[model samples]
Target: MASSLRLLLPLLLLLICSIHGGRGQPCSTSDIRVEQRTTGASVEGQPEYQVTVSNTCDCPQSKVMLLCYGLNSVTDVDPRAIKPVDAKLCAVAGGRPLSKGTPVKFKYAWKTPQDFPVVSSEIHC
Candidate 1:
């Protein structure tokens, strides 16, 4: 019985890690969250919003792409931070890794708040 437990333990651990992206924690594109709030500031007579993009995964998220079609900001967004890939996508962090818990922040001004949804990301454990 003890021998069975010893063999089973490692198998269980391997299964768990595989299910959790090998970092002892779950990782997915959903782990990327974008939060925005009005900064109580205005640019070009439009309300400005402070946007924070954070990774909740235990591993680093790289090549994060966001849905950015029709996104225009009176407050200039830094191209190096995020730039338009095409008509419907934007690359975040210049296609670099976003460390866990460290957020990428930016500001944009528009008549209405825009939603930046995570389209895809590669998790680096």
Candidate 2:
């Protein structure tokens, strides 16, 4: 009985690890994709750009923060859509969980398009 139990335990542990690690593919900042394009509109003499943030992971991601140092738009954006966390980061969707297919979008006006790289997120599988 003891021998069987020992063998069973190791197999069970391995099975659990594989299940968790293999399921849904572990997500990270790389799973977040950012796309920005000119909207052909001007705000306060600055060209407007539309930004879309999407989670490519199979699972939902929450608390999605992006690098946004020195991000200032002459056009006003809703705080709930995106807000500054500090000098170097900003949170998206009010830090709510983003679904796989649904994307969060917002627009800003500037002389140049701002780049938003994913900084951190909590992946929910």
> For this target, which candidate reaches the highest TM-score against the unseen true structure?
1
User: Across residues 29-92, which tens digit of lDDT does each residue of candidate 1 receive?
Assistant: 9889999999999899999998888998777899999998946898679786778899999999
Error of 2 at 70 (Å): 4.5
Clashing pairs in 2: none
Q: Candidates' TM-scores? A: 0.83, 0.79
Candidate 1: the clashing residue pairs are none
Give the alpha-carbon lDDT of every model: 0.87, 0.86
RMSD of each: 3.2, 3.6
Clashes of 2: 0
Best by lDDT: 1
